[model samples]
Target: MRGFSLLDSSGLPVAKTCFDPANIPEALHLDVWRQASRCGAQVDSLQRDWRFRGRTSNWYTDGVVFSHTLCDATHYQRTPRHIRRGDSDCLVLKLQLAGHQQGIFGDFDHFSSPPGTLVLQDWAIPYNITTTPYEVMAVSIPRYLLRGSHLMYRRNPVITWQPDSPQARLLVPILTQTLKSLATASAGEADAYAAGITGLLDGLLLGDRELLQSKYRERDRLEDMRQYLSRHLSDPDLGADHLCRQFHCSRATVYRLFQREGGIATFILRQRLQRCMQEISRMGVVQKGFLEALAHTWGFSSRANLARHFKAYYGITPQQAVEAARSHQNEGQREMNAPYWRDAHRVSRWLESIAPGASPTEPAGAHGGTRQGPRELAGH
Candidate 1:
């Protein structure tokens, strides 16, 4: 179903509405509406005759922030002043899909993104970006799920674009192909597909040294702090103060990081729920009855409350999440055999032919292992 509305974190509708494009000017686009359509987004052809032409960006999510986007022929100049903040803080990555873009990061350094390239930015920063009517695909992942101890974009705050990095080259094609596949997927396939794409993107950004070393250090610190909390979820006293002591950070520091989340109490509860869902999912096929016990095991005092919140965050009941996890796991159980593992051999030979000097590390076939999807990734 195609629709348009702006929503807060609570998922409440609070905005002017436009469904049929005729009522709304082609130049005004809303984030939720653009996400729903799974195409590139643009607000274009204004009364003053300014043009903002970009396709709707594709996205999929399970709450707690994960999204992928593909922008085709995106050109937004003479954009109104009021819309500037909206465009900046959306907290999305921009991978150059095609064409060329040039801008200034600071005084000394200028940046340009050519086709088959990638760049990073946080809405928190002030910078300029422009593209010359090209195709670009990118993912907007929540800072929470990324693994490791570096703040990639926070300091550097930008990756202009690199066409030659082995990682960047591998990513552009994979993302392009994945977005193509996602266009035709069933609802059940959407989340996992989104997950895989997010994983690939995180790996690329986290894998880059410039991203990790300077700008993004605080972000990396917070992620490490969260993972440390997750490892201790079984403790009865697990909460914000405990985390503060464990990380030896100030209450102010902790509070600032989690301010948007209400407080530490809420953050801990959400993490516990996420971990419990992961555990239940690994159990494979199971009845909904198992969830009550699972909730209890996860330290929820009431099944009713747990179910309500879980469904709200995941867009599925805990029972449904379990079922999806089982189906996801079972699908992989069959894909792990030796014959299936051989698929990488063909991919390696294919890669070798196209880019003779492109071998960075040993191909997956050399390790003789199956390709696991994102669901199976170990929590940090």
Candidate 2:
């Protein structure tokens, strides 16, 4: 029996692995169990007609982001005893491309998913999933990425998106296209797309006014704080007091929102350093006093301070990064002149078009340094 093969955008098989119960008579159930366990969950009980077919394509993103396509015959999967040990603490955003499924999610909530419907299932919870001959495309995202979003705090076992709502109407197609596009997307492109997906989910969660009004004020406050920070990243005076004044929130709330990244001050410092690095990388070889000016622009106290922090964060001084950028400038220009680069440039422009407030111009010096680095494309 030929096994499943993961294909690239060019339709070439990047990975292939076969699992057939027929091939191994000694362990008829081993093949299916292997598939289930290796992925995330466990197949608690397999029906007599149980058959499994699955393929996974992982995209290069900030965390464990991947698309798993499966066509399974009849099966029941659960998170039991030792099964729970493998919990990934991730969320599976399953899009029913074909067929249907019904399951008890989050212990109490039951859901039926049909074609075009989107369902979000948290891997941290105990649940049972039952499906017939069904085909599904599921994107697995790390839960922490959605930590501050209201959806992450929802008690619902599974959040399902029907085609009826305005949000679903807009979200479903974007997700479907994103899943389809990942096959061809470069690592840098995939990172950008993954961020787009996260932004969409955040919007979906925040758009639910009823849910937000229930008891999610803290989540809203966090979201607001994040937006304020983004806009004020270059503000040297930005701090807990500024956040408190702008958002009318306490200093504790400001600290809590940024706790995962460090404290509020640390988060701000990191952001400034990141911006400085980007600016330095883009300018390549800078003119006299350029470093000092860039540092001030990004809110660094001084060029020396920026250089120290930049070296610590990126393992190279800002001057080294500028020199590297200059060295690769010609090569980047030649690559940008290529057909593929033109295509990529057009795609980047299109992305910026769709994302309001996104800069249409490619970041300066992006052409030279590690062309497809995730961190490089992350700013795009």
Candidate 3:
């Protein structure tokens, strides 16, 4: 479906469109990226067999937040270089409606949630998400709304609520229903609905309030350190000693707070590399001298140093990234006005081959050693 929209009886705009990659003209199969970007998200890469069907609805309360339900795709989603450069901050609360997902949250901490599980992901941090034909409802909440709510604490990037739990049982249905109502909710009604959802989240997450309350002081100090780091990411001199002196804390305390992000020095380097990556992507395939200057601007010792570290972290050289970006840009421009179902025939064949009992050749490592079956779509 395309160009589909919905509005309330009062004429309030609701959903902008309802689309399914499978039936859409041009068959671009970029629905995953399209829907994600609509909700202020970016994808590092999508599954080769990537196909998506989803709807997005908008709501306004204290601020505008959107709800999205995506189904039938597996991909890695993250804060892209451009989005991160703009300092985008939000929290995505995901309710797994079906299938399974496994990924890393924050710098460490791996998570695998099955169907019916609820998880909270911080948009400020990059994540590597891998899912198999899953349907998930993602509610985008502004970071400021969640600040100081125990949800913002650095140590809790990914919080999971089991579906069978009492809190999940009570809150999940309510949250899902609220999202559904957003499609045609009046402004006043939307505000009340938003408030209700917020209250439920606060109650669910803070139910074990004492545990977070006990570490309030520690969380405060960590936030302070994190703010300081953010302000001075380009400062090569920023290190453990600098933090200790600035925050008036012991070296041990500084280490403990950042231990999950690797030590203080490692964290700083990672931040610098991240900044460099953003710059490189923005610059595209540019002159070597310009690229080197860009690296120096981000506080790297030299372009060589940037190249080595960037490859290690991103698994791609700076030049390669530039080339890829340029190539993607050129291809996008060429297809700018092409039909949406340009490759419909190819997609149709692939889909057919993966139907029940079909022995389609599976892409190596696509399932990470899991057995292939009809349910598992083959990646090109």
Candidate 4:
């Protein structure tokens, strides 16, 4: 695939391309795969042995991109930084095949995706995905395509559709067949397939778009308030009153929006407490008084205040939490010098190696292990 005429045998500019991790050295396998999966998405190896096999057959056609990817154990994350609100927006759809992907995606916390689930993601929202060695078919559609049907782009960035639903039975097959068609179809045919999929999708979306519009409008406002609380956790005036003015909503309205989260005060407390916990997990209370310091920084009056709420929320005391974190930290310290995790320069080079670039013949890909990248990641 390194011949780099965009890697399409037909030389189509809106070309189909593929990536395999084997083109690079074994040590940088995870790094390059992360780079190609989604720009800025962080990839972590679940296993120290790194049974990493990420092969992607991707096609760009008519405002949509379809990809079929299979991989081994890995954790992928797109954090807040990947939420590009003003950019050319995209919604990614993941139709699970052989394996399950479980993680927190936007507001849907602690989700375990089942097989045949269609997960739609707004690129503006962050997601964390951990997958087993499994097969997945994904489609990336631009936001404008849905806008034609009155779908709110940012309302539900992460939403799952079960395959057994009435709507899913109708829409899921079209989505699946159209995405798979990209692998074998030529440029003209693939583009038409993509357009056809989008058209049919728009019709389905149109049926519900009008109904979801207002519901999403309310969700968007709630999301805005949540974002505000995250950025201003330490601010003294960070409560329902502040949110009311900041977002120009009534006190009653603010309460109504967060009714599911136990009202405005609880949401703020949870955000502050969440950050405090993350700090403890990452650093494990380095100093004697760091626990109190962490509490104060997050607006807790004292260590006792944080401990009381933390125990209520997580069923553990602050000291106990630190002890657990320390245990995990000590375990990771052993791998701090391991070869598979070493050599930043080599990883950078391999990450840089993914150019707009395979042979065309591996029905299973070029070599063993699904496919190979650069030289061998060709679309057959």
Candidate 5:
């Protein structure tokens, strides 16, 4: 983990890091890479064929991550446990410059990514991917940053944009040029670059009518399931089995369809907790007995159970939620609303040795920030 910082002409803090020789010997790459990568993916170096090597460089700023890498045959997996922990707080867009990769994605077809194609990976869903030697430019944007983009990536059929598409033709060159320019981009310029790049991604991905229709078509089914969940949250038997029986859907279909929210179980727990909190907030000066009863009504086995999840999700317990509600303290909760990015503090911690007194769960973008120019990179 090597890092250095500088202040551009505008006095903005610029910091960049590169794990150039991520692992001392190529053979030790897999064993030592996690120390450098806080993203929580399991990367296994392949045996035989060729020696394994890679480098990763990241420019940290603007609630976004810009990465450039060069790596050979590697297998990557993010399990359901990783998604439950919310380790991946950003949706990654990989702009393939060379080589290709194949993977399984809940939201898209199991297809190989071709040179010059842009592939988006929603960290909320699990993945199993392998790539050949390749040079690529990738970006990680926090979920909050794209709230207004109207990107239902989980339902979008246009998972990978080919080099021949009009959108790819216009966007690929722009990103390629942007990455090349980042070696010296000023803090102010980096801000503009992030904005411009995300804007184009939002518009281009949404521009195709056929793709947009596919997204809405699936969204209809998901929406119907959501409504069903909302209506039956208090039912003790409400879960994947109930969903399957009611919707005539399979267990695999239930889990696959809800991967957008992490998974079926995760979605159910989060929703129940949220509704429980709403009820608690209004129960001013409640007694222990009432809170205990309220917890069960909201699906928790006990008040203690509710408190555990409440603390994890809201950064406060049920009692505190009541006090804050009475005092009208809504600001902090709003800041914590971006659930996906909530646990991404690992990125910031890896980049700059953790901001002073930053909470372990605080997002990198939530704290005081720094900007950086891209540095030499290989891969991880």
Candidate 6:
């Protein structure tokens, strides 16, 4: 494993690194820092209206990789201008959690990856960024580690990926959720997070590498069953018995597999309605005629059926949900073209008393400074 270091409470690199910075070419440092700065500024602009200000950052490695953050007006221009790229390369995966950004990675390759979009790029390359109103979670890993993996090296070098398929979908949600959890993580959790990341990366590349062979085989069978049902949602005959015969599985086993998602018949109906609703949402609420026809066409069986299920799941009737979704859609579009939107600054003051050094009895306020409320100091 590559040598590593971490941050203490003071947020400083606490280990003696092995990588020699003096050997790095001077030109590369300036270029990397320039892009880092622009990326930092773009994120800061997005978080300007929030109650929170500034971010905590740490940079350390045995010269294998570097990581840092520039929050609280800590712009990227302050980074050193020279770096050695021989022993290792750097890849930065930026997750924009709040705002949107337009960036150009290579001369002709432009990206408009919005909030929830993950951007991957090489740090050795020159990149430019366009700012918007939002913050980001950025991860910088050594290129050598990633490139050494047979999986990553084999894939298209400049591909942008999304978690869409059943097998691949877990990657997106898990990664995003982990990143968010990391923001407030304690020192003890850092190593665990790092291990989880590496394992996940390997699984992503090698296709669920951590699972037992039996589990992997089961997943494949389940995935096939799912796809078959999805493709034939309208068939009333699409029940457990059909699945048992098609997959050569026992009726009990088939029923058990789908039990978690409701029985096989209920699951099929749910999927059909969900698909129909997705199409309706895309067409807009005003397309009332098309919407009704689509429900029946998608195997809802009747308008009442659609309405009942839609309300049960979405808390709104089909017509009302469509209207509400349209309103939400229009609002989102309006915000996109604008420079910024107002963020709600309604942070609860009760957070102060519970801050870092606060006593258990204290009513605490959080999100930076100024503790308020009855204070009973702990660990004093």
Candidate 3 vs. true structure, TM-score: 0.51
Per residue, candidate 5 scores C-alpha lDDT tens digits across 1-380 of 01222233554533455545532334333333433354546554332222324555666555567778776555566666665555445567789888777665542224468787888766656666656667789877554444322343345422677888777788778888877777777666776777777767756654654665654656678878877887887776679998898899899998888876678777777777656644653454667587688777877878898889867754457676565344422222222223222223334443332122222233233544443333322111
What are the per-residue Cα lDDT tens digits for candidate 4 across 1-380? 11112223564434555555554455545454554554536665544445346655566554455777776655566667554423224556678887777655564333456788877665555666656666788766554444332243345445567889655787678777876666566666765666666656556656765655655557667777888877888874689888878888799999888886667787777677667755664572489899888888998878898899877755557676666445332232223343333322223222223221111111111232221132222232
The alpha-carbon lDDT assigned to residue 99 of candidate 6 equals: 52
TM-score of each: 0.38, 0.46, 0.51, 0.55, 0.53, 0.38
lDDT of 2 by residue, 1-380 (tens): 01111232443221112333343232233233333344354442222333445443334344434554454433344454423344344566787877677655532344668787888775556655545556676556544444323244234436777878676787677777877786665555655666777767755655664754553446566656755775787777888998889878788877877674467787677666655644553463579989888888888788898888866654557676566445433221132343333333332232122111111122222223211222223223
Q: Candidate 2: deviation at residue 167, Å?
A: 2.5
- lDDT of each residue in 268-370, candidate 6, tens digit only: 7666655664465446436547656766677776788778876665445667645543433322122222111110000111111112321111211212233
lDDT (CA) per prediction:
0.44, 0.53, 0.54, 0.58, 0.58, 0.41
Candidate 6 has a TM-score of: 0.38
Model 4 residue 27 lDDT?
Answer: 51
lDDT of 1 by residue, 1-380 (tens): 00111222343211111133333343332222322322112221101222223433333333112223233222222122423323222234567655665443321123556766677654334333334445556655433333421243334545555668776677667666656665554433445554665566656665665644643447567767766766776664677787678789888898887664457676777666655644553464576567777766666766776788766644446665554334322121222233212222222222111111111122212323222222211110
Summing lDDT over every window of 10 consecutive residues in candidate 6, give the lowest-scoring window: 342-351
In model 3, which residue pairs have backbone atoms overlapping below 3 Å? 25-340, 25-341, 26-339, 26-340, 26-341, 26-342, 27-340, 27-341
Candidate with top TM-score is 4
